[model samples]
Target: MLSLFSLAHAMEMAAASSIRTSPRASFLTSSTLKCGPNFISKTSIPANLMEKGHKRASLFSIRSQQSEPKDGSVILPPTSDSEANAVTIKDWEIGRMQDEIVSSQGIRIRRRPPTGPPLHYVGPFEFRLQNEGNTPRNILEEIVWHKHTEVSKLKERRPLIALKRALENAPPVRDFIGALKASHLRTGVPALIAEVKKASPSRGVLREDFDPVQIAQAYEKGGAACLSVLTDEKYFQGSFENLEAIRNAGVKCPLLCKEFIIEAWQIYYARAKGADAILLIAAILPDLDIKYMSKICKMLGLTTLVEVHNEEEMDRVLGIDGIQLIGINNRDLESFKVDISNTKKLLDSEHRQAIHDRDIIVVGESGLFTPDDISYVQEAGVKAVLVGESIVKQSDPTKGIAGLFGKDISV
Candidate 1:
């Protein structure tokens, strides 16, 4: 029988050949790795076949082995927690393929890199320089990455258990979905979800004299069905404290915690902070995450507004179950370009049919300014509209709502 070294060398040769045939964006270097006994699959080559006096063949990674897959993906026997955290030889090579798949679908947001443990050898640690793919191409991606890092730090300060206990004493959630429907019935037009905006990355300092509580009260008086409170402090110049303040001020309108929710922890946190509902951007989350997080929100008695900017994102949200509110964003998160037509484009006959058949509520968001703008989006197929800039910029946001609808529906 050929020796293990010869067998391994032959495998590496074959793997390298396969990798070369693919596109260059894969960024895979040639693998001519030397032999370790475990490099070969235990099933493919009998364990007894390994000659004596070699490192007992454990997959050190298919770094340079004939035993690995032709594509150079290292498939080790399910490792312990420690090994799981350790960065193996071909970790990045294999992961590069996964990154390519996520990026191929026009999703420029990269997954956080490997977290190899600081004290390796027994625990799982992801190998991240902490900024692997963090250099975002656009404003949306930058905000998402920043939020991911921000949430990770926040979790340490207030773990989920602590947040859960906070929820115990927290006020009960209002009927956020019900409020929107009630307003629509009261008024012949779409329900208004007025935003409490202080600032945005795209539009800096919406109101220099910003009072979250005051703004919330104004929206309520102006006939807002619900209020969207920007809780992201850094980018949006908002805070969870603002949400808590609005709730404490006895503003009767149901509150939507508008933040970049990257983790499930934030949902519990928002609920604890008196959020009646939460916003889930489909662009920032995968299908599975949206599904899982929506379930968590349901458990917490918090409604979710699943936001989508394009047809692809809308399709992914549609594929999910238990999504009650779908917000079609006129502003493309990736490009930061606002087009009210985006609402019409995404809600084609097929999408509208599915939404109607399911009795789902479609919310038109962003770039809505005039009566014509409101009517245009309403005609496109939305039961609700989330207005921020046009209304928030007004001297009296109460009048802003009246101007938005062209009449005082509050009475």
Candidate 2:
């Protein structure tokens, strides 16, 4: 067994090997979150994807770096921030980048990615969301904006470096895509990624008596190939403790940490908490952030469920690499308007061909409440379905799975 110190060293060595960037890069020319190129220190780095040992790649290179660039080399650091600066800059920069990401993709929406570090804070680390035009507009947006504060607090309590060490003791990740594919081949139906959801903004308190472990066990017994646990505490009433408990309880189904991830630090945090996969909403994250974050997720050995609500987002995602699973959310995140046909609308033949060509497994998410709903998405080319309200609200979630498909899916 490795000690914590040994594990952190191993993670650094592995990170150095995995985090190579491109050399042919110039610094940013656009107006970005420039609070204190100013504030961030080495310790402020959520996870040192850019830093190899004591040295770090240039902020420029780290910002635009890709998983597999034609010219892969970490940029030379122009300068490092002071301890005060690092804290100030990161606090200012947290949730703002998501909006910037959306704009970079050439898609215009009322909502934007986090534009910069956390600027709306009381102290150095205690932060809040300002009513910037970049601020959140809808319930989902408000939840995301609030998450900026919540996650910053979480990260402040447990820094990225600490999470890296904890990962050494985490459960070995199951093959998330492999499980879905195997279940699909066996069931002749969409593989179930049964949702361990507690509450939603649209529907308050999915189950009055919510037991995450109990629901996860029921899903496993009901033949779910994978499970998704809502880990956000404010809106969803979920906690990472729930994820840890489900893992400790020893259910074999791989777990997806269903959090609104706005920063790379959340990826490492998820792995440390025993999550095998994490959600990356395309609606929320821009293309570059997705590319950068997805690369980080790969380095950490966490699978990404890149969620998209429409075609433009789908095209942007297909343009990225190392993405194996794409989730087509039937609900419009901005409007909270759900239409099951959104799956078919986005996964048209051209998109399906591109997805098939690259061997991407498409997942139909939300508004899937029936066998017909399941079949519709299956015919539309989804290999899996992420169902939450339909099953979790049922008295017996295990039987709910069978009723969902109009037959028993468990072998």
Candidate 3:
């Protein structure tokens, strides 16, 4: 059986590009395909096409080679045992090939499992597979895989062309970076990007009575320069509705749509929902994707806050051009571990010098609690901080900010 991960990957790729089938291969028509949570399509493939030597030029470059009869129904030839096995083997190859490209860029997380270990036959007996490719290796990988399915379905409903039309009524863009800069100089402290998050996979529910707009207003009143709204509904328990609601609520602080962004389509979606800035995590995105997505944000008048967790990710972001804002996250997305030193470690003398030369603003993210924590990252060269949990959970989040920075920052 082809795993859901494989199906999602194949369908997403097919939907993304025009189908071009080779004349020699067997073709599955759209009638044979069904769409639903429980629906699965039983399609046939020729054994020869699954051979090792056959390959595509790129990850998205998929080629189909089957022809359909005039009646729209084609007879599938009976498959031998070896041929039946070849089907899954080919699926495994495609996933492995795509993963190899990501791993080559120093990324530890695999986009998807290289489709579990191939079936092993030992003297006419098959060994049971212990671990499967459908299982995610870490929290971050799991989130990315889930996002793949979520985005695919969302794109289907609101296609890119439709989303473009909605942009006509999207609220005007705000100066996200300017707000942070002004707050930093005004307060002589790290400008706050207070996160309006309700829950997390690691931290569970942080606020039982979560009012996104109320928290946003409190943060702004407490002197936050920008607001980071968690827009992921599955794991974060946040939604784009909250983003739209907050923006429509008349909050003056610029909004950052904090999402696990994997596609350029998401950029347009965020802008259409009233986001003034968007986050791009260097850990999940490769260099090419970061560059491409950053350009898209620029065109949409949205600031890109490229986040880095380690020195390697920091170095990769530094190599990219036209990046004005960089966020150093102290938490490890994979392990869900928090360490304040991660901020200080990545912004070393060498990287700090490069950032200074390029005029990139570093924002310290996560694992921040007190005045000492803010001061530590400030000393490490972060001009701003993206903080959550500590403030949002307090009875009065406005007073919480005063405790965080050791004084009232409200002007």
> In candidate 2, what are the lDDT values of residues 178-272, reduced to their tens digit?
99999999999999999898998888899999989999999999999999999999888899999999999999999999999877788888898
Mark the 10 consecutive residues where model 1 has the least summed lDDT: 117-126
Q: Which candidate is the best by lDDT?
A: 3
Error of 3 at 202 (Å): 1.0
Query: Model 2 has how many clashing residue pairs?
Result: 29
Give each model's whole-structure lDDT: 0.74, 0.73, 0.78
Encode model 3's per-residue lDDT on 10-129: one tens digit a residue. Answer: 654553232233344443222121111111122333333322212321121111323333334343433333333344434555556556656777887765544332122223221222
Cα displacement (angstroms), candidate 2, residue 49, comes to: 32
Clashes of each: 19, 29, 5
For model 2, what is the alpha-carbon lDDT of residue 354? 90
What lDDT tens digits, residue by residue, belong to model 1 across residues 201-254? Answer: 888999988888888898999999999999998889999999999999999999
TM per candidate: 0.74, 0.73, 0.80
Candidate 2 C-alpha error for residue 385, in Å = 0.2
1 versus 3: better lDDT goes to: 3
